[model samples]
Target: MKKYYWTFIFLYAAFSTNAQVKYADSLLTAGYTQVAAVEYERVLFETQDPEVRNEAILKKAFCYKLLGQYNEAYQNLLRANLFDENDSINDRLRYESVLTAFMASKYNDSYNQYVQFKYYSKDTALVDQAKVIAVLALNEQQKWGLASELVSELNESYSLKLDTAELFAVSKRPKIRNLKKQQLATTFFPGYVLVREGQVTSGLLSFTLKSGIVFSTFYHIIDKLYFTALLSGGMYNVFYAGSTEHAIESIKVNNQKKITRFNEKVSNSLFKALETSNFLLF
Candidate 1:
């Protein structure tokens, strides 16, 4: 009976219509991501097994990440981490969880998990990669003090051939160059409020900077620039309040695109006006 199921798994995994997922492990091994994504999604529907599901999810996310769909890839990477973080499956999920978090730019998450990963494997290469990522993130976030500390802990000799001192200097360039801008951005997008039926609320409505907020912010700014006022706000609210992490966590996309667009325009205009007149004390 066990053999029968194993045979089914093997045959299904072998002959899958998704040449990508069907042959992902091999393709990944050979660095053929261009052909791996198709099989990954196919594998999603091929089996209900969590392990298989996770493998497919990671591959799919990796495909998107490589394709520059950073947001989509991050979502899938997050899902895999959430699943694998459980004590029941942490051991099996550690490698992918750590890898996905790094790919998704969730440095703190990957770094925190690395301490756990340290006890589970002897793959020095993976360790080196993880440490670099953690340092890179710290560098990006302007914690250069912490980044330098972490860098010192790493064995500089293990760096890849391409990761020379000059490249390392260039790597820290993001921190040095964008340090001011990142700090200012946090304030630029301090958050938003919830307005309904002529009433404005804050706590249940404030939409702060987050993975989801970044998506909506970019969308709204684009929409406003295009003068599609109604459509822009609607889209913004849908994404902004669609989750608790957003605003009210109750905004609907289809029902409120116009309102969302208008609200954003008004808010943006007000921000500009305030700055022009120096009415807002920053």
Candidate 2:
């Protein structure tokens, strides 16, 4: 009688687990991913069977991933424990990990993971997809040189849908100027920095415009109270100082901004290309 009771208890547990899983599937079918994820988590915790637990965790991870909760998704993927480093399942998981990091704006992590995925997977199609993502990661970090090198390695037969010529053009380093000298020049002469940087016409134009504004403001005050003149001059001096500091910072950072714009343009193009190729991992 005791042995029969134990058998009945085992049957009840199995049936209960199956019912819970069925409910979770219904939630998923209804597009209630968050609710489904909770249900799956419950299953993952309660199920003693390794295979069922792994499948539950994997489903939960997918639900989180679809919701753009990458950290949670990656954690659950790891919890699935369905793959080893060299297994095909491991390769797919690595791809998902890299993509999740990319979506989270963790470009360096994505790039490093893609490198490993590429090296270990050795699946030509997956490796090619990794290359595209890796290049995009480098572009986001403004590592033009590395991005350009990766682009070169890509097979010409495959189109990334980017203007290859434009990519190369934008990746080339701009002519380096003496940054210190430019900063000093702008600090000393705020309105003339553009002129000194070979934009003499625009620089002088700006300087003239600012001087005109300053002088014009005081022109009417010449005949007014002495206090008014004093106030005007004080305000002019403050504006000049602030403008000088801003000009110095802008000059110093101009080269960096230039590179950033190029990278941004190329990265946008790369994304468009990926869309057409259906390479985005989602």
CA lDDT of 274 in candidate 1? 33
Q: Number of backbone collisions per candidate, in order?
A: 11, 0
RMSD of each: 20.3, 10.8
Alpha-carbon runs more than 4 Å astray in model 2: 1-25, 47-58, 70-88, 156-166, 169-185, 191-261, 264-282
Tens-digit per-residue lDDT, 1-282, candidate 2: 234323432342343346777687668657797998999999977877765665566566667776769788766665655444435445556666676677677889889878887777867676676777788778777676788777766625356645566676743645445657765775556567776555567567657756765675678477776676676677667766665665566565776676676767776776666667645333
Q: Determine the C-alpha RMSD for candidate 2 after optimal superposition of all C-alphas.
A: 10.8
lDDT of 1 by residue, 158-256 (tens): 331222233234343331123234334323443422233122444224443244455655676776654444555565556444433332222333124
TM-score top scorer: 2
Give the total clashing residue pairs for model 2: 0
Which prediction has the highest lDDT against the true structure?
2
**Model 1 residue 265 CA deviation in Å:** 40
lDDT, each prediction = 0.49, 0.66
